[model samples]
Target: MSRLIQDAYTLAKERYAGLGVDTDQALATLDQISLSLHCWQGDDVAGFENPDAELSGGIAATGNYSGKARNADELRRDLDLAYRLIPGTHRLNLHAIYAETGDQKIVRNELQPEHFASWIDWAKANHHGLDFNPTCFSHPLSASGFTLSSPDPAIRQFWIDHCIGCRQIGASFGRALDTPCVTNIWIPDGFKDTPADRAAPRRRLKESLDQILAVPIDRQYNLDAVESKLFGLGAESYTAGSHEFYLGYTASRNDVLLCLDAGHFHPTEMISDKISAALLFVPAVVLHISRPVRWDSDHVVTLTDEVQAILHEIIAGGNLDRVHIGLDFFDASINRIAAWVIGARNVMRAALLALLEPTDRLRSFETAGDYTARLAFQEELKGMPWAAVWDQFCVQQEVPIGIRFLDEVKQYETRELSKRA
Candidate 1:
C-alpha cells in the first residue's frame, strides 16, 4: 500500500477506462492464466539421476554460475523460492532424469509412479500442478544419435517403454492433483550430417509414437503432446520430428497436442504466426516459450516484439482456452533463481500487456477497412500505462513489487547458493 504504487494504479485504471478497457477484468484474466515453470533451469538440465550425464539432445545450458542444485531436495528448495518470487501460482515441469531414486539403480524404462511420489506429494502440499517429460537423450541408449526412430528395434523399444512410463507418471500427477498433466515427448533422433535416406527414419518415428501412445490414459488425468525441431546441435542434417511431422501427427489424432516451441524454428520463422493456422486443425497446443538468437539457443525470454506477438495471437485469436503455456529457457550464466524469475516475469508481463489491449476495437476497425486507425490504435497501445497495472498486480499477488525481488534472490544467494561453491 505504498502511496506511489496506489497513485500510479489509480491513474492507470483511469487511463485504461478511457479506452473502453476494463483494467480490473484484465488483471482477473491474467490471474487465471497459470504458467508451467521448467525445472531444468534450477540445475542447468543436469538431473539428480546422474549429475555427470551430458545433455545429448542437441540441448545445452550455457554458463557455470555457482550453486547449481545437486539433488531433488535442493532443486525443490530453489524452486520454492522462485515460485514465491513469481506473482501467480504455477506448475513445475519435470524431466525423467530428475527422479530421486536414493541409492538404487533404476533406469528410465523401469520408472514408476512411486519414483515420483515425493513430487506428487510436494505438489499436493503446495497446491501446485506438475508436468512430466521423458528423457530420451543423454544416455548410452541414445549414443547412436537416434532414438525411437532408430532402426535398431531394441533402442526403439527402450524409448517407447520409457515414454509409456512417463505418461503413466503424468497420469498419476493428474490423478493425485486433480490437474491433467501434459506429458510431452521430444527426441534428438537425427544425423549430424545429411543422411542418405530420411523416409525410413520418419516412418519409424511415427510407428514408435503410435506404440508409446497405444494405451489410453484418461484425458482427465493426462494429455499427450509431441514437440518438433528443425535442427539440433548434432542433428543439423535433419531433425526426424520436424514441424510438419508433429503437426500432421497431432492433426491426424485429435487426442495428441502439437507443441510449438519458440526457439525450435528457423531464425526468420516465428511461431506466433503459426498458432492461428495450427489451432484450426489441431485440437489444442502446448506452447514452449523461449528466446532464440540466430539459432535454437534457448535464451531467457523477454518482453520482445516476437514474445508480445505470440501473446497477442493467443489472447486475440481466442486460443487462450486451448493453449498450455510453459517456459523453455535455461541460462546458467547468471543466478539460477534469477533466470527463472526473469523469464517467468517477462512472459507474465507480455501476457499482461496483451490482456490490457483493446482487441475488440482494433478488430472492428480492421473489419471496417479502417487500416489507418487500426494501426494507430495498435501503436498507441505500446505506450499505455500497462506497467503501472503490472506493478499493482505484483503488489496484489504479494510477491516483489519491482526489482526488489532481486534483493531477496541475492540474499538467498549469500545465505544459501554461495555456500554451494
Candidate 2:
C-alpha cells in the first residue's frame, strides 16, 4: 500500500470516528456489494450473433470508438483490462445476442450452454459470476416494434421459446458457478404513434410472460426478472411493459423480480424512492444503474446525487439483502475500458459514501421528529473525507488510485485499442 494514501486514510478514519462512522466497516461493506458490469459497453452493444447485424430496438451506442470488441476473445480481453482497474471482483452481465455460434446457424431459440462454454470457463477462472438477458430486438420479427406481445401468435411463440432457452442458459451458469444467475427479460414492444388499444398489447404481454414463467425452474440455479421501459426511439408513444405493468406482475408472482432501470423512467422519476415500495411486496428487485440525460440516453454513470441517493436508500431501508445491483449503460464516446472502470468506480464510491453515513442517528432524529437536526447532520456529512478513504481502498485492493489509474487506461489504448482494424 502507498504510505501517503495510508497516512491520509488514518486522518480520515479519525475524523469519521468522531461522527461514529467506522471506515473499516464501511470499506468492508463496499467490498461485499458486487456491481455486475454490463458486457455490451465494451462492444458498443454490437454482439457477435451476426457480425453484420445492426443495432435495433430503439437502442444505439453513439460513437465510433476505436477498438470496439469484434469477437468473444477481444471482448473478454477488454473486460480483463477493465477488471484490473476496478477494485475487488464483480459479476458480468451478458445478452443472448453475444452467444458464440461459430459457423453454425444457431437461432436464439436453439441456443445452449455450449454456445457460452468459453464464457463459463473464463468467468470460472476469473472467480466472477454471470447474469443473462434475453435479446428481443434487432431481429426481423421485432422490426415491427413488437415481440412477445405481437398479435401474430407465431412471432410471439418464437420469442417465448427464445426466453425459455435463455433461462436454461442462465441456470447452466448458476449450476456451473454455484451462484444463482438472474435472467432478465426486456422487450422493446411498443408503438411510435398513439395506439387504438393499449390494453391488448399489455394483455398479450402478460399472457406471454405467464407462459414463459410457467415452466418450473429451480430457484437455486436461476432467478427470473422482468424489465420495463417508459418509451424508446420509435416507440415514444407507448411501451407495453411499463413500470406499472412489471411492478404488478412481479408483485403478483412470487417467483420473479422486477428490474428497475434508472434510465427507463421519466426524467422526473427517482429510482431511490421506489426501492422501499418495491421491496415491500416483491420478493426481490434488480437495479440497472445508469445515467439518463434528457431521456434514456444510457450515458455513463457518475457519482451524482441520484446515484448516491439510490445507494443510500438501499442501505437505509435494509433492502441490500433483497436488491441485486448491476450497471447498465453504453457510452461508445470514450475508451470502452475507461468507461467501464469509471462507472464501476463511481458505483463503489457511492456505496462507500452511503456506508459511511451515520444512518442510525439520523433515523433516531427522524423518529423523534427532530427534522432540524436531521437535515443539519445530513448536510454536515457532505464534508467528510470520502476521497481519502476511497484512495486507501484502491491502495488496499492493489489498483491505481485517483489519476494514476487513468495512466494505465491511456497506456492500454495506445498499445492495444489503437491497433484494432
Candidate 3:
C-alpha cells in the first residue's frame, strides 16, 4: 500500500507539472499550515469546572454520543488520539471553563495561568501551540442572556475580568510554547425579542470591550480578537455583537483581529466573500470554520464547496500568513474522534486542492480578459488527480490513507472509548 501511494503520487506529479503547478512545493506549503482544533468537540463544551451544568448561553450539543471526555485528562488523551490520525501538527483552542482546579473554588475572574499549567506543559512536550477563549456562556452570570453587554454593571465587570484573565493565560501558553496565542472574546449578549433601546446595549458593549482590552499585551506572546454572531438560540431578534459591530471596532482599534465564524451569519452570506475585504482594514483575522445546517447549528465540517472556497480565498489573497485557521464544530451523533479526524483531514484536503490549482494561470487569464479560458481551466481542475497527492501526504505524515483510517477509528472506539464508561 505504501509503494502504491508513492507510485500514484509520481504520476500525479507529472500531470500537475504540465500545468505549471509544483505538487512538491504544494505539499511542503501544506505541511506548515497549522489548524487550531477546538477542544469543545471532545466533550460537548461541558468543561471540567462544572461538567453537569446545563448548557446555557444559547449553546447546546444534541445527542448522547458515548465516550464524551468527562475530565481534562480524558479530553487531552482523546485529542492525542485524534492528532495521530491527522496529518500535520496543530494547536488546541481552550476555553476558560476547561480550567482544572482541584477542590479550590476559584471563579472565572480569579482564574490564573497556573490553572492551565498542565495544558502548557503538554503542548510544550508535544510541540503544539494553544489558543484560548473566555467562556462567557453556561454560567450563572450569563443566565440573564447578557454577559459583556449586561445591564448589571457587576455582571459585565465579571465577564470583563474573565476575558482579561484569559488573555493572560493565553500569553502563558505562547511563552511556554514559543508561539503567539490568539485569545478571542465571544459573548452571548443579545435579546430574544425586539428591544426598544438597541443602541444602549451596543454602547454598553463597546465600553465593556474598551475596558477589557485596555491593557496592551505583547504581540509576540499574545494577540486579541473579537468575535461576533448574527444570533443564537435565545438572542434571535438582536445580537449586540453583529458582524458590523466587530468589523468597525476592529478597524478602529487596528490592534485586534476580527473573528469570522462561517455559521455566524445569514444563511445567504459566506465568509469567503468577506475575507478579502476584511483583510484590507485589519492586519489579520481568525476564522471559525463550521457548518450551519438550519441556523447557527455547529455541525461537523465536510469538504463542501464553501470549505474549498474559503481555502481558495486564504491562499489566493496572498495573505495566508496573516490568517489563523481554526475549526469550530461539534457533532454528538457520531464517533467524536472521527468527527475531529474527518474535519481536520477535509480541511487539509481542501487546502491541497487549492494549492494544486495553477492559480497563476487562472489569474493570468482573468487579467488578460480571457474569461472563457478562466472558466474552462477552473472546470478542468475538478477532474485532476489531486487525491493521489493527498494520499501520499498522509503516507509521509505516517497516518492511514483513505478510508483505511476509518478502520483505525473503529478499533479505537471499541478498544479505548468503550472502556471510558
Candidate 3 RMSD to the correct structure: 0.8
Per-residue lDDT tens digits for candidate 1, residues 1-421, read: 5789989999999999988899989988898888899999999998988889778878899999999998888898999999999998899999999898888979999999999989998999998999889999999999998999999999999999999999999999999999999999999989999899989999999999999999888999999999999999999989899999999999999799999999999999999999999999998999999999999998999889999999989998887889999999999999999989999999899999888888899989999999999999888988998989999999889999888999999999999999995
Q: Could you tell me how far off, in angstroms, the CA of residue 73 lies in candidate 1 after the best superposition?
A: 0.8
Considering only N, C-alpha and C atoms within 3 Å, which residue pairs clash in candidate 3? none
Locate the minimum summed-lDDT window of 10 residues in model 3.
412-421
What would the C-alpha RMSD of candidate 2 be, to one decimal place?
Answer: 0.9
The regions of model 1 sitting more than 4 angstroms off are none
Once fitted onto the true fold, the runs of candidate 3 whose alpha carbons sit more than 4 angstroms away are: none
Per-residue lDDT over 1-421 for candidate 3, one digit per residue giving the tens place of the 0 to 100 score: 8888889999999999999999999999999999999999999999988898999887989888799898988898899989999999999999999998889988999999999989988888888899999999999999999999998999999998999888989888888899999999999889999999988889999999999889778889999999999999899999999999999999997789999999999999999999999999997999999899878888989999999999999997777799999999988998999999999999999999999999889999999999999999899899999999999899889998898888988898888888877
Give the C-alpha miss distance for residue 82 in model 1, angstroms: 0.6
Stretches of model 2 off by over 4 angstroms after superposition: none
TM-score, cand. 3 vs. native: 0.99
